[model samples]
Target: MTKTVVMILFIAACVALGALSGAGNQPGEWYQSLNKPFFNPPSWIFAPVWTFLYILIGVALSATWYDENNGRRLVLFAIQAALNLLWSPVFFGLQSPALGLVVIIPLLVSILMFIAASWRENRAAAWLFLPYALWVAFATLLNLSIVLLN
Candidate 1:
């Protein structure tokens, strides 16, 4: 029971960190004024999608943390998390799609590295990160499109 609770809290912390990052860097008027691709999702879509993704990330992290031989994997997780934390600020806060691209490319790579590393520790962890990887890949494309358009 205690272990379960610890897991839950750990996961919650990861989710919370992502949420906090988003909250701190809101898509304000600066974001709204920018020209986006036609395929850009409605503003309403991001919250729920990120919420779900963060949960998956949290679970993946917990699984990786508990796995044996997870030292390198955990480092990957931390690197990815740092990259994740930087995206909103660079993209939204700084209001630079070009810079967003800079940050997200690395963020995407870190996520891939984390996913690949996770596979060595836990398959489920790797699986859990797939959606995140996909999302970031799509986001990278979106960012690229924006940089080109605007």
Candidate 2:
């Protein structure tokens, strides 16, 4: 019962924190300014997709909690999450697609590193991150296209 509660809270907090990175700012304004790539998903798709991704991230984070008190992995996950949050404000709020592209590169690397680290400690948890890594990869490409086109 306690573990379930903990997982719920952990998922909620992580998703909230991630949401903070992209919360403010009117969508469609700056976003429409960008020359989105052909492959870019509709703007309406972001909210639902990110909501799902956050749930996955929550699960991934919870998986780490099972591996003893490994503060290092927690810190790594936090670092990546913070970067994930920052990308939105940089890209949309500030209207800096180039800067957003730069930001996501490190975020991508951090997530990859997190997956690598988790692989050593928990393979299942690392596997959960695979979708996230793939999404970031697509995001990176989309950002690059936006930067180049706009």
Candidate 3:
């Protein structure tokens, strides 16, 4: 397959997997009853934001995939992806914001690590993760808030 095709596949797979992870682990009454911070965004915003971020993440992954020297980058990508997928289940499915904090803190670190690892080799890939990093930072704060409030 062509590189373009492979990149597209990566993006599609990322978006699909992210959607699937979120679909089964939605916030029900338990989440609604929790005391949220005033800065909490409306529920509708998460899907679109995550979709956009996943697209960036997929592109970053694809960008690094072809590079033989990117083993560390790939590993960081996988770690962050796994952590990302685990967050919803811990936070919403199990209704444990404290556990979610445990997952997200490292997730944010891995994302930053990925950006740092990719910076010299593939600047675009690192740049792509900038928003993801910022978002995760915000999410970490939000998760911490939820944990403290309740």
Best by lDDT: 3
For candidate 2, the per-residue lDDT at 98 reads 88
lDDT minimum window of 10 residues, candidate 3: 59-68
lDDT of prediction 2: 0.84
- Which portions of model 1 miss their true places by more than 4 Å? none
Instruction: Indicate the worst ten consecutive residues by lDDT in candidate 1.
Output: 1-10
Error of 1 at 88 (Å): 0.5
Clashing pairs in 2: none
Model 3 per-residue lDDT tens digits across residues 31-64? 9999999999999999999999999989998899
**Every model's TM-score:** 0.95, 0.91, 0.99
lDDT of 1: 0.88
RMSD of each: 1.3, 1.6, 0.6
- Clash count for each candidate, listed in order shown: 0, 0, 0
Across 1-150, the per-residue lDDT of candidate 2 in tens digits comes to 577787788789877876665577455565776677799897777777787788888988888987875688888898898899888888877888889888999999999998998987888879988889999999999999988898
Better of 1 and 3 by TM-score: 3
Question: In candidate 2, residue 105 scores what lDDT?
Answer: 97
